[model samples]
Target chain A: MATITYREAVVRALAEEMDRDSDVIFFGEDVGKAGGVFKVTPGLYERFGPARVRDTPISENAIVGAGVGAAVTGLRPVIELMFADFAAVTLDQIVNQAAKMRYMSGGQIKVPLTIRAAQGGGAGFASQHSQCCETWFMHAPGLKVVVPSNPADVLGLLKSAIRDDNPVVFLEHKVQYTEKGEVPDHTEHVVPLGVANIVRRGDAVTIVATQRMIGVAQQAADELSGEGITCEIIDPRTLVPLDMATIIRSVQKTGHLVTVEEAVHAGGWGSEVATRVTDEAIWSLEGPVVRVTLGAGIIPFSEPLEHHLIPHKARVIAAVKRTLAV
Target chain B: MSEPLSAAMRQQMLQRMIEIREIEGRIQELFLENVIRGTTHLCDGQEAVSVGMAAVVDAAHGDTVTCTYRGHGHALALGLTMRSMVAEMMGKVSGCCKGKGGSMHLTDMPNGLIGTFAVVGAGLPVTNGAALTAQTKGTGALALGIFGDGTPNIGAWHEAVNLAAVWKLPSIFLCENNLYGEYSPYADTAPVENVADRACAYGIPGVIVDGQDAEAVYAAVKTAADRARAGDGPTLIEAKTYRYRGHSRTDPAAYRPEGELDAWLQRDPINILAARMIADGQITQAAVDGLKAQAATDAQAAIDWALAQPHPPLDAVHEDIWV
Candidate 1:
């Protein structure tokens, strides 16, 4: 195993996938010579050349729409949308075209495409660029939503997404780019979609989170350990074919649930988890599903307001306390 | 200014236009008679654009075409099985989309017909995407995007064209400028010399054709398709046509002027092509009549097959949501 940052893992995974399959390629704005704004695709252009690693026009619709077309024609294209918020510019292609192609075509066509976008707002990106739009993709059926909290999960899930014969929306929280973790050295570490991992096992409240929120939950869990609140954290690596079974069973055992999401509290990813838990495991719940989410509204440009808008570790801890209080 | 078309291709083109007109006429009758359920956007007068542009498309592997709501003629002309298309309109199990998609949503993937969108300008991005894919994969395929005049103003249209030009994608933007967008007239909707003129803004050649002249459109599209396949980049061709029918089944067309429909009918693409074929002495009247008869029989057979097909099972609604 080697210690690597989430960003490094993503680059490695994309490079390895391109090497493994000639059909696999990466394209997006500044993804070629510049190696992406965050350098997530660093050194790839030189290694793969322009055909496999391309820099596209500053059009989100073209970036994703091109990816969809390429995928349907037998190329596995992984496109970067720079930021998650820009996905709205091409939601029709993503939701209407890519998400519906398989079903609309009666399974005659497959969109073997993956969209990687930098999400979350801890870096003080304003509302237009900083919003965590995970729920938008999760709400969309036929799309596999994957949000890995660590380098290992990111590498594994991306590799799997590239090979899958379906469209996947891989939301990489920008804040997690620098976060380091131990990733397996194996070049073929594949993590299947629709599977969740139990990061920490505890009998107390079950902390269901994804991507950056998983790290925050882990940090909160460590602090809560001294207070005798053993929090069980579950990282739902993939959100669409959600690993609800694992989460439901965990909630049943713990009898308490606290869902964490970086997006706005209103109609966020946490809401889906909360609703599912209520419908499936309501009788097993010791109390209402406590939701630790960002305040409903835009992410402010000001650093302090941005920090205030997103849910912090303290908020996560408080929610865990509230859920376990009964 | 240029010669219209060769006698043989002209007659064939006119037959296609008539086929679309007759099929749409039959569809309207069936819709009112309750034989066909759901809404429809007819292409009665706009037959020339579909037939004219389709005359130039390659339609081979990798080559794709995406149409807008008024897409029946486009689908049929691209060789989509009339039976499956009619079945889809009837919401039957054997429909092109397995009955999930109705008239507005038609998909024929096996024919390299990517799909069409109900939303007016939605197909622009889709076709542009296909062109982008073709360019990246080095397939030498061309994507023909058929949209109405109103779509050029939409954001998707601009984004699609701009991206295509920047990437030098092998795409042809076929704007079927039928002079109206639903209830509103073109003057009220768009303010430009021509929709194709906007293509110059994207650094691509733009041309306008007499939409009522199928040969004129075919010529322009053929040249554009050649340039695209040769890696010269995208082209925008505005086919100036008119719609004889209302925008939808519910529209009575009160927005049209006196004799406007009659004036357009006089310049019908099919009749004009038929006349040219006779004047050029390439084929006898008997041949034109025979093609029309064949098209009618084919259309009737489609209707019969659609009527005999079973309705899609309610369970199948959730099936296409994923591959």
Candidate 2:
């Protein structure tokens, strides 16, 4: 067992996958000499060389398209988009080509590509760099959405996604990259998709979160424990083939729920979880579901406004309090 | 017949053109006859571009090709069985896409044909994606994307080419410049004279070849293929050809001027190539006539096969949603 930050765990997973398979390659902006903007791919360039760990131009379309092409033709490509917002520039290649090639060709082709993007809002990077666009991918069929909330899950899920035969959208929270945690010592550890893990057992409220929000949920749970409010946190590793059953069962047991995400409140993953909770386990709820999310307005460049744009522990704790009211 | 066809390759090219022309013609006739369903686009005048370009890429390399809505000629040139194509158009089970992809969605993956899309500028990115795959996987294969002159104006076209150029992707962008985009003339839509001229913007080689001449198109594309194989990056080729038919089956081409059609008809690619073949003593009159007869027979046989194929079951609609 080793203590590693979420970022180190991600880098370790990538290195292990590249070492295990000769066909696995990595490419993106600043991934070469700089080890990526967040250092999630640090030391990969020297280890794999330029051909395998390439630094591409600032073209997001090429970054993603090259991965799609390479994946379909035999190579397993892990492409990094500097920020989640940049995926919009490669939508044609990602949504139209990579996501649909398997079905479009009537199963004649398989796109075993992994697209990694940094998400979450903090550090005042403002609007362009901090949006959690996981919903955009979750809405798109033929894609697997993975957002790990801890170092262990990050390592395990990243390995699983790399091994998946279909295209995967792996989201890493920029805020949680430096958060330290203990991961399994086994190099072959992998978590299956569509399974939600109960990080802390409780009965008062079920706090469902993704990526950075998972850490926020844990903090809220720790704080709420003093008030006799035992919060149960569930981290859904994969969003596309969502483990709705686990969430629903938790809601059924707790009778109250608080969902959190880094994206704007409207049409975000929080909204998705809330809708599913209401549809499947509404009768079990003692109070209305609380959603802690980024403010609806555009992410402001100012430090205070950008901080306000995202949901911090205070907001999550407040949301928990509201859900437990009465 | 005088050029260098030898009555075989020339014969095959003509049949492919006719199949495209007739399929479009028949699509119109069938629409008028009320047998075929949905919209129809014809490649009546620009047959040389798709057919000629396909001659350079071999299927054994696992190469891929993408095309736009004006893709009948492209589908045929890529070696999709005529019977499967016609069946697909007829929405039959035995069709290429099992009738899911109508005329605009013809595909034959076994032949290394990626598939066709109806979106105007969509194929460029898809082609680039495929080319990226070939380059990264060490496939030594190439990808060809066939689009019209109007596509260059779309953001995808620029993005696709820029990406291909920077990555040195093994791809070719074949511009079938028939000089028209729906009702608008090429002069009004395009800012430049030749689409190939824009290649320099991306730092790639540009070639403007005679669109009507099969041999010329083959030669130009051959060079691009060689460059791609040699890791010289992508090339943009503008085939300045004219379409003999309307943009779609029902179009009367009311926007065209009177002598414009006559002028293009005078330079018909098939006639010029055939005349050269005869002048050069490459083929005899009887041989040329026999080639045409053989094409007709082959076309009829394809029609028979297509008609006999069974319709796909309704359950197939739910399949292949994901891999």
Pick the TM-score winner: 1
Residue A222 of model 2, lDDT score: 87
lDDT of 1 by residue, A56-139 (tens): 878887678778877877788999999989999899889988898788777777999999999888886788988888789877
lDDT of 2 by residue, B178-282 (tens): 988887899898888889999989999999999988878878888899999787899999999987767776688889888998999888776666676677777
**TM-score of candidate 1 relative to the true fold:** 0.96
Q: Which residue runs does candidate 1 get wrong by more than 4 Å?
A: B1-8
Query: Best by lDDT, which number?
Result: 1
lDDT against the true structure, each candidate: 0.85, 0.81
- lDDT per residue (tens digit) for residues B22-66 in model 1: 788889999999888888989887777787777777666578888
- lDDT for B165 (candidate 1): 89
- TM for chain B in all models? 0.95, 0.93
